[model samples]
Target: MNSITLEKWSDVVLPIPARYRAVITRDHKILFHETDMTPFINQDQRTFREDFMMYQFDGDNIISIVIKDMPFPPTHFDTFTDGTLLLASARCVRTDDWIQKNAGRYSLDGECLYKFVLGDGISAVAIDDEDTIWAGYYEEGVYGNYGWDEPIGSSGLVAFSSKGEVLFRPHLPMINELYYLNIQKANSIFAYYSLFSAIIHLDHFGRVQHSEIEEVMEVGPITIINESLITYDYHSKLLWSLKKQEGVYKKDKAFALKDQEGNDLYSEESAIRIRGNWLFVLNDSGIYRVELTMRMLEE
Candidate 1:
């Protein structure tokens, strides 16, 4: 076995009880935000409802969480250089008041370009380095049949101009997520397999350029950086770094760690992410961060 080291950083305490569907953006600054979800059933009206909240983070600290009376949890978010932020939910809601309240921080045409609605809520969003908005939704047959008679329809991959005009929409069976390939150029987009098993490359027009899904041991959470892909399997606490070459593929074990003594960490169903040098592990208990060191693969 390879050597390992694990250091517990801090616990992110959420005020309102909610499950974190996704983590949009993170940095070493005071401008971080996250989406919070709340599920409630109205006894008077007998209806189900969901709510979303925008959290502002200040250097490893959560300063405030602005709640939005939305029907769905936010799927993704993007911040502009001008201090404006765009939050996108997987599905449409009954109100956009949250956007209105933060209007002054954003540009006049911000809503026209930054806001959106998808046919379904299983969507992912990303803003390229140039500020173009790219979104992806379920494509029919994208996810394996839930039932034989269950009909799956086209999952559309869409790109919008900075001003929110639909630039392109390509019919696909499904998409995992949208990413900006800064190393490739402004015209390329990167999406991962919904289950974090593979990476798909698309152009600005939603065209596939390349794909790689090499099998890794103990599959976990995966992230794409330029041409490199990293997967952190929670089951074994093993980090796998997959590298792609011109016409060849290879995977190498990068790091390994064990869960802390008091916490019942690692879940077969939960997702994981490696940001910078920190590994984020999320479960029903909330999100936890640990510092890890990469090791050379041994024979």
Candidate 2:
């Protein structure tokens, strides 16, 4: 089996008491979430929280962002170049309550500058280089769920301006559910959605293009390794490589995730994540990474 060795970042330590943590692959950063839970009993006896904190790690430096008096625990979030934070949550049952917006813009001091509904079933949220927010929705989000008569993400993918204005929505008919979204810079976007298994490529000026891959990978996003496409089956932990042969991707090489010394990672492979052409694998041994390049693929 073809294998690639990961470069272990042995110096880095994932902080203890990390809750709802995720790697911001494109930004090469780690995000951690923590909430100050204070149960508030409403008239109907429903409990609610009102404060949260987001800890973002830039390599060895930790940037702690605290937002108090506004409890919006995000499932996906990232900061704009201007340092303004955009955060989003998923699948909320209280869609009728406009105050409990699933997404919002917050200041560094944890003040809610503005709040808006991103609808339900948000699988992914990404902001581009130009600070345009992109939200990817699953099946429930598009078809309308949680008291939504007209879902905000009816197209499965949506682009919003920095101030929360709806900018662009693709008219593609194949989008019933979006699984993956890779917004590279402000000019390019890559997405995989629906049951069609087709990859959509779009430009900043609204140009659209796509390529279909018949082979289905049940899990993980599409990772481009040099000129080939990589798809990992998290269930089986089998990684497959594909090259475009006559306009379609065909599987050629296979791999199993290994350590720096080429040791079997086994269950560790399940935590492997792809951001652009790099693989970020984190386990009990700490964080490890490997850059997928043309030279390494051909080796």
Candidate 3:
């Protein structure tokens, strides 16, 4: 396997654990949601009064803002093309009565614009070119036993317009777990469901174009670089290039990631966001920015 070197640019240790999700916005802002575990002192004895927090960073400085009007904590979030923030909270054991108003959009100043309710739970979401939002819902079973068994119910994908209008909703089969959601430059949306080891691709119109299933130990986030679909395997620490061939996504290239001192960089439970030539990785330890150089091979 080809090995790539990762030079750390800027590292920031979050005040709270950012386990839910993380992404770099279009305007070069870093945003991450603190997990439900960080709010309460004790998990067993809970007050249920704590609200989830979303933190933003511009360069290396943290942006300070007091969010007093948020209904619920955000489990996953992404910034719209127009700088608005879209937030979603999954229905889990940690969620309480406030979860009824789980999904919504907020301004950069921490003001809520619109709020909506989701049935099952939202695991991940991404915004497309036309400002359409694509969301992946997870079944209750997936949360049970840490997604060991197949998803109990059939929860699917949903698309919403910028004006908070439901554009389309498609029901999928028993998805074990929806790991992440991403949109390519061509406006095609891609979602990773770990239970079946599948990646479902939807076109700009929210139509299913293909469902590619492969046997892999672990799957993380998916990002499109130069029109190529790239995904990381947490177990192997290998970056794979997925190419569409024969109406399916096939692994084309693989690269192993290593730190400056040649130590293997473990990607377990890590989230990745691509901005220009930089790739941001967030894990339990800290946040890291890697300058990436894509090498083209002869066909």
Candidate that scores best on lDDT: 2
So what's the TM-score on candidate 2?
Answer: 0.85
Q: Give the C-alpha miss distance for residue 138 in model 3, angstroms.
A: 1.2
lDDT of 1 by residue, 149-224 (tens): 2212133355666555667655544444432211123355655544434455566665654455556455544455
lDDT of 2 by residue, 1-299 (tens): 78877877545545433422455635777666754223332212123445576777666787888777544457678777767788777654453444346678887777788877666778888788888888889988888876777778888888888777889888885667888876657666777775677666677747556666766566465665445777776665777778878887777777777886777754642355666667776666667777777777777
Report the error of model 3 at residue 224, Å.
4.8
Better of 1 and 3 by TM-score: 3
On the 0 to 100 scale, the lDDT of residue 65 in model 1 is 42
Which portions of model 1 miss their true places by more than 4 Å? 3-11, 14-19, 22-52, 65-75, 92-115, 139-156, 169-188, 194-197, 202-209, 216-220, 224-228, 244-250, 258-271, 275-279, 282-299
Screening candidate 3 with a backbone cut-off below 3 angstroms (N, C-alpha, C), the clashing residue pairs are none
lDDT of each: 0.45, 0.69, 0.60
lDDT of 3 by residue, 193-287 (tens): 76556676666755555456443546666765554567776676777777777655677787776667776655546655655345566555566
Question: Considering every candidate listed, which one attains the maximal TM-score?
Answer: 2
| Prediction-by-prediction clash tally | 7, 1, 0
Candidate 2 — which residues are off by over 4 angstroms? Answer: 10-21, 34-48, 92-100, 205-208, 225-227, 266-270
TM-score for each of the candidates: 0.58, 0.85, 0.74
